[model samples]
Target: MIITTAGRSPSKLVMKAKKLSTSYGLSYKERGGVSIESLKEQYQDDIVVVGKERLYIAPLYDESNLFFHPNLAMIRAKRMFKGDEDPLISTAKLTEGMSFLDCTLGLASDSIITSIAVGSSGSVMGVEGNPLLYLLAKEGLSSFSSGNHLFDQAMRRIEVFHSDHLSLLQQTKSDSFDVVYFDPMFHSTIDSSSGMNSIRGQAVKSELTKEVIKEAMRVARERVVLKDHWKSDRFAQFGFTQHKRKTSLFHYGTIELN
Candidate 1:
């Protein structure tokens, strides 16, 4: 993917893009004439830009431009911090001073909440199989501001990697983390789930096979959690004991270790 600034823009942004291009091994281009339509015609492929504060482009799935936003993740984290329970916290059974791994980082909403639940002394590692999604989420987690310092702090603490979770799990030592989690994108979702549409293009469309659970169990000291559609058969198929909440579209399947 090529990185470009907004509106054929600033030297500061150009310098920043140059730095990112070098670090990320992406080509940097000048947005001459500031036309995405022209640029798409010029490059003959999908195009996204490193806009002033976020990455944005016309959504592959929708008419609007899609940009990164912590969205409800931040809200839920704030509520959890103020004493309400969160499904992610509940499924992972997180507590202070724990370590957690998020195997499917996606938009990183769950990882952000996991970070908040684990607190300052704890650590959260997020793995993403998609490089573009990784770059977008990693940059968002580091630089996006929500007008809330604590939420932003939690975001900053999350360490995201661009790698397949399976490989990472294989290399991980048993009992290395308090929890290992997955929230793989469902095969399909209801139409109103427009928020995730942008991510669908770059997400790893992998099935959570029994082998995934086995590796997660080995690496986790306490639990391995999978959040999937309530109707999904993965829980029964993979032997994850299921827990469902009233009126929730998703259910948490968990395996607790000794």
Candidate 2:
């Protein structure tokens, strides 16, 4: 069954969402269109489709929660690094004093994870183009830090902005970051029918493109890591040399930049 709340207000959108949930015989709650209980209920044993213009599915039982599903970053990271550590936690070899510019913040999971990895001395600057995702990410971060020490510390170490990747990168000086991380969404070959649907992922994939990589490279100080699919030629066409490659259970790819 398909339910659409396209071009609806927040309150009305929630109403439509609720109607769909009830029709599906699933328990649900509405809190400004960010429903945790409802998601947990619907995704418990099945997949759920959400949003209108940019659609996404959520798997109720995924280990990383619906937001930070392994299918998102983990696969991309593994494909980029070849067989390295956890992509969310270990995509880049972060140092305590280094500053990073995440060209594509997406859901801000990588930024939050990177902030923790970098510790107190390091800083992470993240840019997200989509207003909705940026707002959602900001809200999530704010909520995550409510009276939490780790959240407070992580929030302090990270700076998020709502802007296009290229525009933001143009504003930064050359060599600003020790590492500029680019995870621009390449067209995925994985069937959405079997994987968790991420709202932010779908929006990001639809909006991000290869030109963002060129901008990322221009501003990176030491290196630029472009995440791509194993079969994608975006890296090669862009003249990037492969620095690392990794494979995983679901996907494969390389990490390369000059």
Candidate 3:
């Protein structure tokens, strides 16, 4: 992928884009009063736009540019801080000073919440298989501010990595984390939205298999949690006790180690 600046490029942004291009091994091209469409056609590859605030990746095929945003995490975090119980946090049985691992980080919506639940003394690590998604999440977690101190602190504390979940789990020592979580993309269509649509094209849509669970079990000390479509057979297939929500399309399931 090639990197370029936005239509209005300041020196700082231009320098930042060049630095990112060098770091990510991408080509840095001058915007030069050119349209993204023309650039994409010329390069025949996705373009990364380094805007004043955030970095955006415009896929060659899709118009929905993928960027980093906290999305629902900010809302969920506010509710959680206000004493609302979150299903995933409850399912994982998170505490103030525990370690959590998110296998499928995606946009890191879940990881951010887990970080808030775990607090400052605790730890949160997320592994994203997709490189672009990893870069976006890693940078966003550090830079984005939610205007709420608790939520902003949680977002900044997360450690994001680019790796396959199973690979990371295999490399991890036994019982390395208090909780391990997965929220793989649903095989069956659950809902439709532009955000989800943009992610679908860029995110790693890997199957959650038995082997992955085996490694997760070894890595997690307290429990392994999964969030999936309510109708998914994975809960039954992998021995995760379903925590069904009557009104929600998705459910949280868990395999408690202790």
Question: What's the candidate order when arranged by decreasing lDDT?
Answer: 3, 1, 2
Q: Write the per-residue lDDT of candidate 2 for residues 27-101, one digit (tens) a residue.
A: 444333545435456545433334533333344444332322223433344343363555534445665677778
Candidate 3 off by > 4 Å: 186-199
Better of 2 and 3 by lDDT: 3
**Evaluated with lDDT, which candidate comes out highest?**
3
lDDT of 3 at 147: 88
- The sequence of per-residue lDDT tens digits that candidate 1 reaches over residues 1-258 is 667778856888878878888887877778877677666666654456766766765434444555567777867877886889997787778998999999988768888888888889999999988766787788889899898888999899999898888888988899999999888763233124453465465566666777778888999999888888899898888888889888888899988897
Work out the TM-score per prediction: 0.91, 0.55, 0.94
RMSD in Å for all candidates: 2.4, 10.2, 2.1
The total of clashing pairs for model 2 equals 7
Residue 73 in candidate 2 has what lDDT? 35
lDDT of each: 0.78, 0.54, 0.86
